[model samples]
Target: MPWSAMRRVIDVSGDGGNNSGPPVEQARGRSVAERIVINGLAIAKDHPPFAYAGPVPLEDYYREAVIGGPGAFVVPAEDFNQFASAVRRKMIREMAGLPSRPRMALAD
Candidate 1:
């Protein structure tokens, strides 16, 4: 079958916010319109000091700007050491087509 016929997903794993290219939200909107699910793995390092301490938390940035589509959600890694576990869980959730419960969102 062609790619469009399969379960489509875009897994965006990063340590910082969207810094280049078209705005992430725009890309996400397009992908979501195509019936693709977007999930995020936010890597927040505690050691070596986390940079880009902007107004928004890293996970919140991913939630607000990077991830979209049905059942989209973020898996946060407190540090590099936790990346493996976080990725594993994120993959399982994706492969299982599970929707995140009590989805997190920025306050209105």
Candidate 2:
């Protein structure tokens, strides 16, 4: 099927890096150019042996790894306790077509 007439999104969530799928950069490029928003949710802490697998700074990782498109958003859950609420808020914002606030960076 042609992509222009369809909406395609690649939602990527993992405890670790892209060790088992297609390269993320390529995926981001295509999705963004095609106007498909790639929203991300990263769990900062998981249970048991899998706990350490998640990124230390999940929001940072999402910014660097998963989100794409004009208004892409990457919302992080500090731990499993906040996962559901975070995911709900992210989805609601995305679905409602809300715009993100400007981001600031510190100068050295």
Candidate 3:
């Protein structure tokens, strides 16, 4: 199927980086170019420290990894406590097609 014809998103979440599938950066780039938003949910618990060293700040990792597109976004749950809420909010935002915002004026 043509990339532009894609209407749904593929949300992938995991506790570690690409150890089992295709490289993430390459996948993300293709998705972005096709106008497909890729939202991510990364778990920081229950993993080897070395392999999952990830971002010193976990949010930074999500920002760089999971959310990459014109309107891509991610929600870091930190621990399980925040998982439900984060997922809910992220889903709402994605489904709603981002919130309406004021237009910014650019200087000519």
**Candidate of highest lDDT:** 1
| Residue pairs in collision within model 1 | none
Which regions of candidate 3 deviate over 4 angstroms?
1-6, 46-51, 98-108
User: 17-105 in candidate 3: lDDT tens per residue?
Assistant: 56667767888888888788788776556445533665455556667765687767666666666677878877887778854668999
TM-score, structure 2 vs. true: 0.67
Predicted candidate 1 versus true structure: per-residue lDDT over 5-105, tens digit per residue? 45678899988877788888899989999899899999986555666475798999998898998889999998888999999999888878854468688
Give the per-residue lDDT of model 2 (tens digit) for 12-104.
665455666798878888878878879888777656666645444667767887898766777777787887898798878766775456899
The candidate that achieves the highest TM-score relative to the unseen native structure = 1
Specify the poorest-scoring 10-residue window by lDDT in model 1.
1-10
lDDT of 2: 0.73
Model 3 deviation from the true structure expressed as Cα RMSD, one decimal place: 7.0
Which is the better candidate, 1 or 3, if ranked by lDDT? Answer: 1
lDDT of 1: 0.85
Query: Candidate 1, residue 79: CA error in Å?
Result: 1.1
List the candidate numbers ranked by lDDT, top first. 1, 2, 3
